[model samples]
Target: MSEVNISELNDSQVIGWLNRGGLKASADGEIGLWNEAESALGALSAAQVRTGVSSGNSLQLQARDVDGTSWTSFLTLTAGNTPTCAIDRTVIGATTPAAATFTTINGKTPSAFGLSLWDAADAAAARSTLGVNKHYMSLSQSSGSAIGDGDTRYVTEAILTTAEGYATRLYPMHTGTITRVIVQTSCQAVNGSNETATVYLRKNASSDTTLSSSVQFNSARQVYDVTGLNVSVSSGDYFTFKVAFPTYATNPTGVLMRIDVEITY
Candidate 1:
């Protein structure tokens, strides 16, 4: 037996070889050849990778079946957000993201950008770099003899007389804007409709500046706060919480109690 050069054969000779079965069959009958040809044609082609604007504020990255009947979605690139992929159909003009099975974000590494930002020597340095403020103040009664100017009692226990004007003398540790002034009381003033808790800030040796608006309290064992404030302050600034009960049925002695300040830099 010798190897035949098929290119050297004439048309009739080639036809003779074909009629005698030249192409090998992988399965029974000629069906395997047809299936192989169909598979080779049905596989994904480079020309099917498509990209275009299907609608306003929307995009389509799609593909279709080689049979020109069925379709599939490979990577659907959204406009406003990162690209996420899912499913096996082509629904062009997609505004919202797909079902979010395969998510792909477009920025950052190691969660907080990098590991070097968290490295610092002291607690203060670390707080500074991380943009976090840690300040806590539990101001109690100031050690004074009388009840008018030097009285610094936090109204819960020290408000003996209705005329004993008292407040909490606080020295701020951080430099920031006073965002919240929270007050906690054991009980409400007996007739404290006209009563209020006011905050004051005096930087260095300046005049007493009223920082935030007054917060009224009526509920017992509940939290009351003065929020939505932008009171500017610096370190070593003196602050005061004055609970004023101008008109009262019963003197709110043990009623007006605790004060907590919140700051943000």
Candidate 2:
């Protein structure tokens, strides 16, 4: 019928065209089908038809033909080398630090029972006393209280006041040798009399007494100090200091008084 080259034949047609589905070639030298012995045919492989199921290009691997223990060598194909992408180099900063804020209030109340200094209505000018040692003191009256060794009570009505003068008790209750003293005072004034006061260090109604200091004032608030005055106060002892206006001086400018006394041993 028609003459056709075997190489140009379709795959299915070539298979059927061969007698017994095989070919007769000269030797296993070129790319031609060979028909040696059945064992020799086993060394040759059929051409594999691979189909790609995904959208990517197809990839092929090197294959060999094997006999009992030997194989036909295969040539390497340099076709599919995957390409690499570049990476960017950079230094990114971290998040900023948070700011600080205040959380609570810190405050304190004023000291009520310590040495106090205030002006009186009778003094011609301000008076200050320094270094007057304290022995012991307390506010036992219904209206006032005192601060003493080993005593820790802070309350109002621990101080006494009047137009003429004020009174509180003191005792030297300490552990070591008694050294110096501090005194605080406040007073109410009466008319025409210069604001005057007498601070005392005494044991009782009939005992040893010392006039450590005094003050004179002409107004509502005043402060006075008696310093370097030799007076003694110790631990676990009682002493009293009375702030009084000179009596028999008729209608002296009277005022309420406050006293803060401190002693060191």
Candidate 3:
């Protein structure tokens, strides 16, 4: 029969064969084992359980659900970052780290007024190159005359093409409407007299009917705000200004400055 000294053994070993399985101590003394029945019974023991770290710079957080179930992380470990760093939606903004492009309008010579069109050459600054559009038109001075009667009819409108002008850039608005017309002229007559000049808007280079008319080029810069006129302009519809020399004998020679027509939607 095997014998155990009571002083050197525990209650579990003493009553092992007599009662339900009891506690036992291992040789290493690191672990104390108990029987399944005794462990399930009124066993209330104190243990140094790890609740959280104290004064630790790094902390490990376990993801859990509302039901207290642990969950796995979805993201992979990245190469260049600190483990403690975090990214949240609250710190995010509307934009991203991608390149953005914008649209613009440009001006060219020969166009009576400033002309603009869509170009793809990335020509924004003065040094950048610009891609010219073939369909557009360009306007420039056609002829020069001495100071004569205040005859705006002497002004002419020709086809504005890329090859003939300094820059092949001009666009006509077919469906758009003519918002305004401005005519600049130099009355070289010695008297510097206020003269009445007739302005005309012709369709297709035919100086027949004036779509719109102005009476005087009193100053060097004559402007006619046609927004109230409500004139409809189409693609093929182009215009020219005419100067009527009422006092031709007094002012024999007259000079034409510029005629500008603006069409907008």
Ranked by TM-score, the better of candidates 1 and 3 is 1
Question: For each candidate, how many residue pairs have backbone atoms clashing (under 3 Å)?
Answer: 0, 64, 18
RMSD of each: 17.4, 32.2, 19.4
Give the per-residue lDDT digits (tens) of candidate 2, residues 1-265: 3665555544323222333333322243212332232111211225632222223323222234345454332321122244222222122134333432323224433233212222222222222223333243333333322222222122113443322122334444553332333444333443323534455555443344444434543445555554454454445555555554443233323333444445543
In candidate 3, which residue ranges exceed 4 Å CA deviation?
A: 1-143, 147-154, 157-174, 188-192, 205-225, 252-254
Q: Supply candidate 3's per-residue lDDT for 245.
A: 48
Q: Which stretches of candidate 1 lie over 4 Å from their true place?
A: 1-109, 112-131, 140-167, 188-219
User: What is the lDDT ranking, best to worst?
Assistant: 1, 3, 2
Model 3: lowest-lDDT 10 consecutive positions:
48-57
Instruction: Report the candidate with higher lDDT, 1 versus 2.
Output: 1
Give, for candidate 2, the lowest lDDT window spanning 10 residues: 147-156
Runs of candidate 2 exceeding 4 Å displacement: 1-167, 171-173, 176-182, 187-192, 204-209, 212-214, 247-254
> lDDT tens string, model 3, 1-265?
2765434654344235445453343343322333455431112125421111222222122234447576434222222333333332222245333432333233333332222222222344211223221122224444445544433344544222212222322346545655556555543433234545455555445533443344443444444443443455566665544445456444533343455666544
TM-scores for all candidates?
0.38, 0.32, 0.34
> For residues 111-149, could you state the per-residue lDDT of candidate 1 as single tens digits?
443343434546666666777864556543222212232
* RMSD after Cα superposition, model 3: 19.4
User: lDDT of each prediction vs. the true structure?
Assistant: 0.44, 0.36, 0.40
